[model samples]
Target: MTEEARPESPDIPAAEFEDSDLLRPIVESGVGFRVTSSLLLLVLLTGWVIFGRQLLYGLGVTGLNQPVAWGFYIVNFVFFIGISHAGTLISAILRLSQAEWRRPITRMAEVITVVVLAIGAFHPVLDLGRPDRALNIFTAGRLQSPLLWDVSSISAYFMASTVYLYIPMIPDIAILRDRGVWPHWFYTFLAWGWEGTPRQHAVLERAVSILMVLVIPIAVSVHTVISYIFAMTLQPGWHSTIFGPYFVVGAIFSGIAALMMVMIVLRRVFHLERYLKQVHFDYLSRLLLIMSLLWFYFTFSEYLTAFFGNEPSEMRVFFYKVSGPYAPFFWAMVVTNFLIPVLILSFRRTRTIPGIFIASLSVVIGMWLERLNIVVPSLANPRLPLPTGYYIPGLVEWVMFAGGIATFILGFVIFARFFPLISVWEIEEGRRLSVAETTERLEGYLPDPLPSAPGQPVSEGG
Candidate 1:
């Protein structure tokens, strides 16, 4: 029998074949992919079913109550949104700085931003109980409400992040198009007629440069606005001036952790060890450590100020966190967010891949706990003379939380099935251009050769 002949892709030069491994996941699927995708889909479906129950039964199905009106949903919303920062902000910064090691990692980072942002955005609807009530924010919303600000900022962020994610993907899409990958129309359309011409490359670079600069401020403002939701309030723990920067720091901290974990998992799953090397993890781990320290500093400053001020209302919430019912979670946040990460990430002996993974996992958990502490404690201990509130997340909330996670995983899985998780074009671009660019940049950083005693020849090394 004659073997099938593949169509020739004239646009793809021989160099495009250099990193065929990056395209392996798109072309092949094994049992692991099937099982993982199936399980994730099941969890997502279950979450939707539980959400339907909540919709029918009302917000009473959840742990929300009079004073502690925000529970798991809001906490998860903030946490997930915080995780979204792992992508666009970090990727944009790396791209802007022209970090050569960013080639294989930026795509995954940007993907995290877009996927997690979608899940996080949907959470407000879940929190509303009556999902229809969310529309009222657009129609009858007041500028005075921080909730309105959240909607505006998050919406802007979502749009910017989506565009930022897509623009960089066009060349890859065009490659897939030329290769005649399945769903030809999809790749062809999204490729936006990319032809790999010199002008096309120049245009893409300029667009990415402009977008990277623009995305930084938008990404920073997103979490800051989310912080304002709590900080603008007169409530004790929520009313701190530091909350804006605190929230941003925590978001970046959690984001870096989440990004690292995703990179590690994908590296193992796709056998991408060649692309995601030890240096990538090492650099990222250092950033995570720095953020961990910053997180601790903010946490310390916020609490120290509260401790020193000694206002009766502030003390109520402060003790409620440090010694009251929330003490366990609060302390756990310190250990996971600060101590574990710092200890594991500080020493070279413990900063291996596995250790970094553990540190990243700890930071993720700690960040969630941090969000919980921020949201529940202040509301639980109101300034008014009310009973101390307690919250145990209901089954629906737990399932929805699981579903949010499942959704994030499934989004990555599906994206991998269609597109390369590591940016193929960027990796190729780095190989083709970054070495020389970096050399030039380094030369710029060095001192110029001396005049060499009027007429003496300068050393070639100089």
Candidate 2:
């Protein structure tokens, strides 16, 4: 196969070998990467063991019961799926906007989307108590049901996300294929005969553009449909019209937070300080801060509508969340989602890496509580004559939860082990083209450069 021409980025060091060093994760002698990956794999196995145990003992071995039956599994399912948005949606937006800083971050973002989506999708089957019969969604399922929407949209998203992630990696994989990395045949196959001809490069860019356009709507639809599961219901908190946008906003909020944490972790682990610089973290934290404010606004708007309407059933549920049994979690959600992030990220002095890390972690915890707030309180205090219900996830659920996280970490580690976490070609391409590309793009916005002083030697097209 013909080797693709490697464009040199001026910003990259002259040695060109530093690029090889960046590729070291895929081709080196690193003890820590191996040991940590092994540890994470062992933990992931425990999660699978829990899944198998639940399959054997049936759903009864866990804490699920009346009203609160949608427990930690659903909460985490939503939370993880929400985290998936942090990757593809933001990546697509940044890419479409031609944001230069996105180059280093999009790869991890898409990886997060694919990995966590697989994890999140597992929960429905876990909730089912009989996962083998999952195909019955086709045999005994109704398209009219909201569950079908979740199934269908999420499936579409998984397929699209996988393709979206894989296509862009082709040139990079081809790089590996040429280098004759240990997995030579694997990279060769994924590279898909990409010769990186000018025409091929054009086609690749066009394909990414089309997919970028397509993925944004798919991503939005995925979360909107998820919200529909609650909005379509008649439950007190779930029945609001704002539920759809609220959930989407919360998804992006948690997603940005999760992405921030992932960014920080990956930066530290792979020694990607040069690529994933402080500015990247600072810019991302700003987005996280914006989402935090939006989250607060939605939370306020949602409660204000409910509280002002004086809907007795809604108020009952509201009071339970605000002052009753779930009050601690509710306020904790507030503190983490709003209070901590705003306090830390709002000020320039506190928006440093550590400050952002604190906010990001707090936002993640807060968002989990937000998911819990949405899923549990209303169900526990259903309007029916049934007595108050509560849910506390037993060992199986918690184990499975921990396992999913371990699986995510393991997936990321394995991926980094095989491939460069940052896109080598994209960064190089940016370094070569970003200045001129940016200049041309900005020139489009300036009204023909003030008409070139009316006729005083207009320059070319200007």
Candidate 3:
């Protein structure tokens, strides 16, 4: 393998490794470098115009109305939040399970979780009919309201996830500082003068380990609290005990799909196939498939119970989803979320890179539909038996949606431009640990490494 394609061995000092096998290509690739920059500026300008419109005309310009106070903004909010769950859960699970292949992918995933969470969590304020009265959420905020639960839990999730991303990033930031390419003062400030000394490394490791354990529960709580916003409401379609786990599972499902899609794009754009190998895709595909099944299970249970129980309100909402105006989206969600991914991923041959990409794309679409299903159908079938009005997002909402996507691309692209998108140092550590672990496993199955006398030369196996 080429030097740029191979990770440094553990024996090599991290300080001497100027470029990592995983991240060098990304830094040097120049892919999406200019396109993302221009797009970011465009998105920013467009977003400004949209917000200006909203400011001038007020929330009346948007589709939100009495009773159905949330619309595309809220749907996008949930979609983004679900996608944010991708990083924390994947990183924590991989760390907890000690997955060797997670080394290169973890940082990107964690960064996505942090950034998307910030974007998603803010969306509610944007949805407020009278946004200037937003502080009413605080001054008159009832702790009893599910909205308050959402506020508390999402804030906690954001803080926890951000810390999770930052803690691991400090060591890498220190590496950048040592290289003298980053803004010296800025990186120096962020790095906190990490010397990579044994003592500092030990403390960093302990802190990261503790945070990893802490973050999982916080992540779960965030999604659960979001679901509670619907469930705790006397809403017909949402009042169920199943919502907490259902939302959590759906968040994780969508999160992994987003992660896989990001990894695919980054791998091709930055030519990271060497570090983020086919094996990584293979493993992640299996994970995505597993999540697909779990999502299906939850969805089935949720809808089935509602349908079978036949409560007037719940049945009205459920049938609206099944056969009403939203039926196209609802069925499309099933096809995309379950059928496409499950079929393609279940077969080993079809689990190749391109196939996996298609499956990931399907999952992304499906999960977005899932969010829409959760948001729209219930609103369409209110218990009051009033005429169901359609919701078409205003131009401002559309612009903001596009802007949100552009911002995500811009942030990740800029990050890739400056820092190694992959964790160079972690890849090296993984190489050593993976080799050691594999060797141990092999020894259990095969002949042991040949022993040598005290003064004799050792065999290659040794």
When summed lDDT is taken over every stretch of 10 residues in candidate 1, the lowest stretch is 1-10
Worst 10 residues of 2 by lDDT: 6-15
lDDT of 3 by residue, 163-259 (tens): 8888777777776676664467877898887766566666878988988898898889888988988888788888889999998998998888889
Give the best candidate by lDDT.
1
The residue pairs that clash in candidate 2, if any, are none
Off by over 4 Å in 2: 1-18, 449-462
Error of 2 at 340 (Å): 0.5
The lDDT of model 3 is 0.82
Which of the numbered candidates is closest to the native, going by highest TM-score?
Answer: 1
Better of 2 and 3 by TM-score: 2
lDDT of 1 by residue, 1-462 (tens): 111121332335544487878888886767878999999999999999999999898999998998899999999999999999999999999988878899999999999999999999999999985697778887889989888888888998899989999998998888888888888999999999997766777788899898999999999999999999999888898998899999999999999999999999999888999999989999999999999989999999999999999999999999999999999999999999999999999999999999999999999999999999999999888777889998989999999999999999999999999999988878877776679888999999998868769777676562
TM-score against native, each model: 0.95, 0.94, 0.89
| Cα lDDT, all candidates | 0.91, 0.87, 0.82
Candidate 2 has an lDDT of 0.87
